[model samples]
Target: MPNTSRRTSKRDLTLVAVLVVAAIGLITYLVVSPPGGDDGAAQQPAGPSGPSASQSEGSAGADESPLSGLARRDEGDPTALGPVDAPVTMVMYSDYRCPFCAKFSRDIEPELIDRYVDSGQLRIEWRDFPIFGEQSEMAARAGRAAAEQGRFWEYNRAIYEDSPERGHPDLTREVLLDYAHEVGMPDMETFTADLDDPSLDEPVREDLRQGSSIGVSSTPTFVINGEPILGAQPLDTFVEVIEGAAGQQ
Candidate 1:
């Protein structure tokens, strides 16, 4: 395992506590609120590293709809895959520039898709939670633009597959356009236009806001069926969570 910094360790602890508290708060809200109430609220393709199972062991239970407002169950959502009513929904908050997010995309996501999404067991939703500063924000916008053209996933994979294993790289307009072209976005003019359009930026910003509200301070944070799972944990961890959630449904 890579040596964790004190800051990271502290953040992990805080995240776990936040998740537990959020879980408890959710339970209270559900128990008291009226029924049928209306609620308001990746990456490349890096290699696997060490275990992150120890990072988040929160009390967040999958049995409750803790993330119902954020699950984006709309059948027409372009950034989501699998059936809208899939038994389990995996909401991934990630940055385009985060290497760990890339690793998760490259190493583990494909298997999850094959085993869960393709089989009508899971739906994966992408949230643009860029936190690495300007370039990160730009990348998020570019991703949203691609998503406008129905090429979000492909553009995201291109970004990660082209990324280095460490450090932040400059994701200038030239490079982002290159990625868009590489993804075979049929209408380059529309794609570029969308990237330049300010209106295309709101979903990414909303994602960041929603993620922050749930205490996500890092890229690649995931909430699977309302159960918080941190980092690019081993595939087995995902298997356990997905199967458990699916079984419950």
Candidate 2:
């Protein structure tokens, strides 16, 4: 983790709490977004250590080698998102509103879980990058609320799996709570209260500020060591980045 020095303001924390809840709403948008999140909420892809998203577009040649020779398929954490204790730490700045974040979580997170996180070789950290959309904040808060019940992964996964479903609904507190109920989480009242806990606000703001310093401008921007890997890429890209990071230690 990076060193902490900056202090957050009251407004920032307030925004943090709201963003968490809006994350749920963002997931709802995913259900109605185009495949691969290419229009509207999906913006231009940024450059990477290798080829940029622009380099592989328009011609329709396909990027089969995007992450070639990058990672070995492996089993990851079935029930967790962050790392337990990894020598290499991979940090992600993601907005629930960004369909790309949904894609990355669905496609790449599993490989990280199977090969590195589950094996204790790498520790992965996710920082909310809600992008301050209409309801992005809510979705993030919803995830945090679920985290209080040790069911963050379940809620996050549920959102991804349903990203392609028909119809849409605002990701309200009731909806998040409902998902919690479906996932067999603990008491709803207790977890729901944690969502409003003033003490929890600081961490969320701190994450936002820290991510800004590293040039992250969108969802699913990743940093391995001091290098940046921007965009929602294939799992193999993650493998290359993660393995390089793990080898550093």
Number of the top candidate by TM-score? 1
Estimate the TM-score of every prediction. 0.75, 0.62
Q: Which ten residues in a row have the lowest lDDT in candidate 1?
A: 42-51
Stretches of candidate 1 exceeding 4 Å from the true structure = 1-65
Q: Judged by lDDT against the true structure, how good is candidate 1?
A: 0.74
**lDDT top scorer:** 1
As for candidate 1, its clashing pairs are: 41-69, 44-160
Per-residue CA lDDT of candidate 2, range 39-148, in tens?
41132222221123443352123322221111111124222344444556566787665556677778778877888777878766667767746466777777777776
In model 2, what is the error at residue 76, expressed in angstroms? 18
- What is the number of residue pairs that collide in model 2? 22
lDDT of 1 by residue, 1-249 (tens): 345566667755664564466456545654654322333221110112111223112212343444443465666788889998788889899888877788888999999999999999999998888877888888888898888888989999999887766555679888999999899998999888876788867777777767765556666788887677777789999999999988976
Error of 2 at 186 (Å): 0.4
